[model samples]
Target: MNPLTAKRIAATGSAALKLLMPGLCFVVSSLAAAPVSEVAEQFDRHFEQQLVEHHIPGGVYAVIEGNQIVRVRGVGVRARGGDEPVDPYTVFRIASVSKTFAAGLAAVLAEQGYFSWNDPVVNYVPDFSFRSARYNKALQVEHLLAQTTGVIPNAYDNMIEANVLPDRILPHFRQLDPMCTPGECYGYQNVLFSLIEPIVQQTTQKDYATLMQELIFDPLQMATASVGMEPFMNSANKAMPHVRARGGWYQSTVVPSYYRFAPAAGVNASAMDLSHWVMAQLGHYPEVMPEHLLATITDKRVRTVRDLRRGHWRQFIRDAHYALGWRVYQFGDEELVYHGGWVRGFRADVAYSRDRQVGLVILLNAESNIVSELSTYFWSKVFDAIHIAEAEQFSELHSTEDD
Candidate 1:
């Protein structure tokens, strides 16, 4: 009726719209957020199926997102026909995954001026030698961690596997010929890689195990992480390594010789402890995993000839390369930092995406091809979940604009 009354009614309507808009936006945002628990449950189901299909005796895995462990689970028994079930606390030998720790520790020590990655190995271990005088003179600390020492790949693995003492193996480096100049090629190493132990020992006046405990395990509160066969076997919650027999998995006797190459393959830990290790690697704990140090260790130092198309989720992997102690894979546009380990009957895989702040660690007591398959499946699921959440958020934003 009256002009003034009409204006007052219009103002009240505008105020109500403003008040309601925020609640509406809140609802839309909530709808866009992915249900993490649901995704985790789905992953658990898939993982369980995989364990059964692969006939794995025992396994444990941890999935990490940002600073949190989103999933921590285990399937199957600790030993074939044994009543003990695998769980987050059950420890397994991480094998060559231990090299990642060695690289990280070297980076930390380098930052503190203990040694440089490029420092000559001979400077630390003056007795170090190679059949080729050129390689003997040119070999640097970085070359060892990168597995680019120009020595034949796994040249001494047979000896190591045969239970030859590492100290005895050390002097035999003079007997093996260099395949190329140091840092020119990629070669997977075990005995030569353990040379980092002597370098670390000489620089810090402490053994590699003590250094890892002081720098990594202690700070991250990885209570179950340790190096050496004695501690691993003596631990109450350790998994018995297993191997596939004629028709099924069977437990294997512990081999103590690998402990001598502690820097390369001796670290043992549980999935629960490794979740924290992954979190630190993902930059959750800056004090423990300094950005510069991480950057140094994760630098793409060498190219690998690994074919991604051979795996189940081959479509996602574009290329693969090797960083110091870790492998880097191009997954679409994102980079996956990964490493896999095999020692006797045990197998391990660890991987993380820096951009997504997501990671996975899988440990199995029985040797099998399941680790690679499960890794691919796990990453596919994670990327799918992230994409779905993003799509929902985009829809919500556009709908709000139209309204």
Candidate 2:
């Protein structure tokens, strides 16, 4: 909230991060012990012995269970050419991972009766209008969060990239044709998705950033998480994003372009902060993120077969769908709620399984496809370990009957 406090939070980067429990904590059935957990065994070797040795800049990853952060470690420096090592608490812009927080905030407000999901968007921001008067009246708070506005995907996002304000971009929507009737299908959006900002701000009579802080971050104890560019740029122990050029990673300055859409791409957080976020999604904190709220936000709404075909995610994903702000991926019979984010020089992936009570968050300061590969490989191991343990348990039970 304040400059001094933000710096104090950043100062926490120096705290010694420890491996509390690679302690065979992986969950199998209630009656079963897991096949010796191997998901994190080569994690350090992959990052320290491999990624760092390669030309990439920096990143941080944390493994968290529903009730505790299992292990968190940062592998590289905060900036490409600087000596400030990235620790678990080093703040990085999470990009579109901010959408989860936005949707969570909206759900928080909705539960408080500040506004209803079915409420028309025009009630909050009367200035916003669509080409069709019928569609304008039909668009509701839930439609934007669910990505079913029937607007073209990423509508006017290029204007945001060119440093245009959303107010300027809002009027242009009046000129476009609908892709589908409201709530009929899925079409992703950045500028359009953020219409929730005006809705939340107006209904509660609070700024969007302040509401997110009061409702979500504070309740979840995400101390190092902050919204907007000022806190991110002012924080001393923040990760500077990198762009690959001239055969090496180079430090890149944070641009205000995406920050203009705070609800869409402007939240900054540390791995320490986001570990708590992932844990909350696993339903650890009921007061802040209750089961009802979780169910509302992550309830499968629209098919997203395309996301299942992402680079490393394609083969294993049996099905995929979009919820409020999350993606529900069917991994065999288990469900994984997940999202990934990217901007100029950053990439982030957050995912968790409610059934298993395990979650992982990965943040990278440089743009690299390696993050995708690494995330895919880790989750694959976790799923594999679960299956093998179940098979072994079945075999043991069958043998016991024979004996």
Candidate 3:
């Protein structure tokens, strides 16, 4: 062989000899496996690169499919000026993610005949009278969850400022003054849902958080999930909220609300725990779930919001509706149930498609709208990967068909 050709042959021969050796056989075997480490590296790149681009303080994410946690990672810091890095154990204020829990608790009660979807609001809380008599009686549990109660948007900002408990604000339905007749238009009302917290507690004789623990978290073994205020604040694994202001990120301190409103936004949990919650929602593990309750939670009651942003022809959220807590969307043939939350300096998004057996949870401390798009992109990427994997799997299973 020529000198260059001889050198190439020698190198190849040495590499093959090493691979054939007893110790190196293990390395070869690992290499031949499905490249799990490489997959993890790529997944981390996708998460960390997005955080760096968005200036998100730091956050955690988990991907679950078919009752398995395929990926769990934390990127960035615990807070803006903190030296601590986030970990799998880091807890985040799950914001409207709590809404799902609230809605679930409501479902549990509804299944027991505590309340019905079509039940009048005035029946549960006599003080829930609206300015218009027709709207008052027309307002139902379904309407509250559907965001079609003719309430103004974010009407609870001043409510929180006033230190008013949700029950105290029930009488203020008349103050909303019917922006549109009940069921005629959709406008989200955080305070209205918060009111349901007391109703759930009163009807079930169990606190909202406790009911969630028994019905959802405990059953799913989500040990790190909680709606407690003091416990989360004092937990060693918890991350502090961060908000961008004055051209830099600042640590956010917890602000007290009038009453513990675990309904609208109060739960805190890590990504691993959330992935378990998502997997339960997917219904792959049926024994751990209450079938009727799951049906109640996932079933769409009304198409409340028309999702005006996407336009009519391509409106994936066109038939968008709300069950108890989830905002339901249809993408082509897939039905996606999702929720995004923001409170103080925390933001979170959890979305999963029931048809695809795909679930994604992203929790970040930085206050930004970019989290929503990042979360949606992650879900799409995961589903796309699943589709490809399934296609390859089928092709392998039928490889001899053509022969």
Candidate 4:
């Protein structure tokens, strides 16, 4: 067979295998690989039950298939005891998922020859300095996106939680210590990403927020996505974040940081809006972005710690690596690209397998370590159901031949 024909055959087989395998349990009986709508409904019900059982205030999800959003679902109340309902347009703070967008922005400018990934940080931020002189020379834009910046645990964690003004934190970032030589270990550090914020400003001659709005958000048509905290709070369709206390769910009423850092964790979006975000990852719209740039950002560069599931998760999650702004995970000989976001009382998870041409996105208002575990469980079951249903249907058809 021709090489191109063999590649096509391999991709089709992988997707068919995904549908034929029974996913993690905890789904409705009607769900089968028979139809996409049935699998979507099963996922909706599975998440609804998870919300009430785990005391999650609310959540939303979208499933994308072959460049289109095939299903979007919301469950529970946005706030416990509140009348607000989670919906397609309801926006939530996506925490670190913002990194993916920032990295994408950097890739765009880099492709335009504005700067290369290996460009020294000090090259742009002329005054840039780190704790050690050797570290200063080693730091590069790739270090920021790859989580290789020798910085210790997030430099501005306190300032971010305290809602400190950005101007206060931006100038003093040179005080943090290096954890390892750059490009040696993948210790996640947000302050390292702070470096990219300045580079984007210097290169584009615009703040990272404006650059993102012009380059990514507007182009993707993610109308509801933004990096502003106050505007999100005042929005009519935004979800109220909740936290579980000793007795029940309580509203989290803390003020947000005044300034935005597009490089790290500062994005707010809806499930519907994020579905399109995943579509962009699959190289669906070449006009908005060059195919090569998207491919560069999603390429696997470094391995991760472990998989994020239970009961056979170890087998399914591997070939993990940190790409530009996303985590690439491989399962059962197929690859999936995804990112998870968490800030305070909000959580978001988005994943899509390039091989299968199918993806899922989940957002929740309340924090529970179990929330992600449960969401993964639910989706895995969906994957399994699709496969089992296909097998059963196939068997039934074959049975007629034997008769």
Candidate 5:
């Protein structure tokens, strides 16, 4: 290394990252930021190779260590037909990854006494009728975000996909009987989960989007993040969605269906924005996302045994449960907090290991299961590194004691 550059790094008195600028150059805002470690470099190479083999037109992934973006890259073009290159700022529809934001907002409001988790959903949206009044009254604010309302899994999700407005679709809940009472069972729902929107709006007297922006996004400095379809469509650097067919990859227009449920699947972000989000969850931005709020939101509330059978995740995930917006997995002896999103033409996966102070976000324009495989591969290798380090430390300690 040159003396000038080495002197700069040494002066920082912290780990300096040497990022591989394939094409894009990201400026490290702080001198203390860590460089791309061997594992991070390997993960990036494996991910890019997979995207090429899978024909994923364009995507971006960011790796975060502590409060630093150690490594981030954009792979491929914005669309299959375009010459526009993707970048760390190329926004993609994060889909259900939006749930984490919703849950985070709820945690923040609840912490500030805007509302309590124990508050009933009926108190805010009295029109949220169900075939069973007992279950209707029993459903609380926590159940909406926790996926434990005991309603049928993905209840009315088809309707949402059919372009049915939530107002029209939600009333249909009264026709069906709930499988179990609130908090008794785990049943994922885009419509039911989004009920948190009305509850928060009513409690805070602010629109859901504004609340998310003021409370979470702005505080974390997620500059490229925005909510709903209009903002995504308006953004000039957004990654247009894509669909894979037998012939090749094809571009697809972003549908307005899922955007109607803003809390469930309606947020746009770039890899850079998500790096800040990861840092907040890792206890870096405590003023915005305090450790208590993180704990409350990620606290396992319902067992999701079905997660153990997921395509690429089944083997590594020994146990699985749904927290408010996140899924907690027992990967060997470690805890993996994760969430994955799939909307029409996009797929996103975000996972972080708090113990290791590491996080990763993968955003893609195509609807492929590669996101899952890539994330699973990453966590597996991360855990492997942890094991090696611990073993080495143990051996060195014993050797010293013997001497």
Candidate 6:
């Protein structure tokens, strides 16, 4: 083996090798089994190579299989030209992945009779109004989570990026025209989507952050997960945001203002925390991610403009649609729940297969399109492994019957 590969194997220890080597043997066995450790190692090597090739400053990733965290690894330094190494506990802005948390909280509240999905926004926020009376009247609680409010995509994201307060951005909607009737078309919104926070606060009589902590974070035991910018900035183990320039990657000095629009784009978490979140999504923690609630949130509500065929993994994706705070893709005969986020110089992507109970979450402290490519590559590996495992199991079953 190459020196680097030998060193890595040694550093990971005999346990990882024991798990991985046997798993490789299963791949060649009559009953092929793709163990979690083997799949995780493949992703680890791929991610490491990508980080070097793309000059990424820092990245943290987690893989979950069969409702268990299989791997958590970090590559590169926390900041460009710095010595701090990132790890599983290295905090990062999850950006719009916060929307998933918002949707979950809302779904939980709905289960408790706090509000119906179809409840009009006006009922929760009396002051809420759209420029078009038709849309204003038709808007429902679900529209915000579904990204079907008919507002222009990323409307006022620039303002949020400019460090404007979310309270000031809400009034701008009154001057904007709706592209379509509510729930009729997909029009992604950041500022408008965050309205869920106020609605939750009004109904639950608790702050949005507190509601998230009590309902989701605490139950999942996501110790490093936190809302808003303060906690993230104050974290000693957090990755510093970086931007690429002509010379090399440089640290960003801009304050993360997206936390002001907490429900839409503000969330900070480590790979370890997100691994538990992924497990919950896969129905491991039903007490928190109840079956009915998961069904409601993941239901395909509207078609998005995403064209899966343009990517290299086009042959794997059959169709794509928008669910509550997630993008649902038809992969073979199963559903792939996915979401990607970007804020300042940070980026994140998360996806899972409910049927297979396999998922991945990746957090990066650098700005690049590589995050999307990485997700596609990771999903391809997962699906390929599942296909092999299933085919081998079928062959084994038939042979046993014949014997």
**Which of the numbered candidates is closest to the native, going by highest TM-score?**
5
Off by over 4 Å in 1: 1-38, 307-310, 313-315, 385-403
Instruction: Write candidate 4's Cα lDDT for 279-318 as tens digits.
Output: 8877786766678987888877666664434333443553
lDDT of each: 0.80, 0.80, 0.69, 0.71, 0.84, 0.80
lDDT of 5 by residue, 11-99 (tens): 64443222222232212211322333766899889989999999899988998878899889999998888999989999999999999
Off by over 4 Å in 4: 1-36, 153-156, 164-177, 306-315, 378-403
- Between candidates 1 and 4, which one is better according to lDDT? 1
Candidate 3 has what TM-score?
Answer: 0.78
- Least accurate stretch of 10 residues (summed lDDT) in model 2? 16-25
Question: Taking the candidates one at a time, how many backbone clashes does each contain?
Answer: 0, 0, 0, 9, 1, 0
For model 5, the superposed segments whose C-alpha errors exceed 4 Å read 1-36, 385-403
- TM values, all candidates: 0.85, 0.86, 0.78, 0.82, 0.86, 0.85
Over the stretch 1-403, how does candidate 1's per-residue lDDT look in tens digits? 4343344346544311111121122111111123445556777888889889888888988888888988899899888889899999999999989989888888888888898888889998888788766677689999999989888888788889899998788888898777888899888899888889998898889978899999999999899999989889889988998888888888899998788899889999999888998998899889988888788788887787654554653555656777888888865445789988888889999999886677999999989888888887777565441222243464565565436
Report the lDDT of model 4 for residue 276. 83
| Pairs that collide, model 4 | 19-387, 20-387, 21-387, 22-384, 23-381, 23-384, 23-385, 24-380, 24-381
Tens-place lDDT per residue, model 2, 303-334, is 97678568766655667998998989876445
Ten contiguous residues with the weakest lDDT in model 5:
24-33
| Candidate 1, pairs of clashing residues | none
Superposition error at 103 for model 3 (Å): 1.4
Question: Per-residue lDDT of 30-118 in model 6, one digit per residue for the tens?
Answer: 22234557878888888998989989989989999867788888998898889999999998998889999999999999899988889
Report the Cα lDDT for candidate 5: 0.84
Displacement of the residue 205 alpha carbon in candidate 5, Å: 1.5
What is the Å distance of residue 344 in model 4 from its true position?
Answer: 1.1
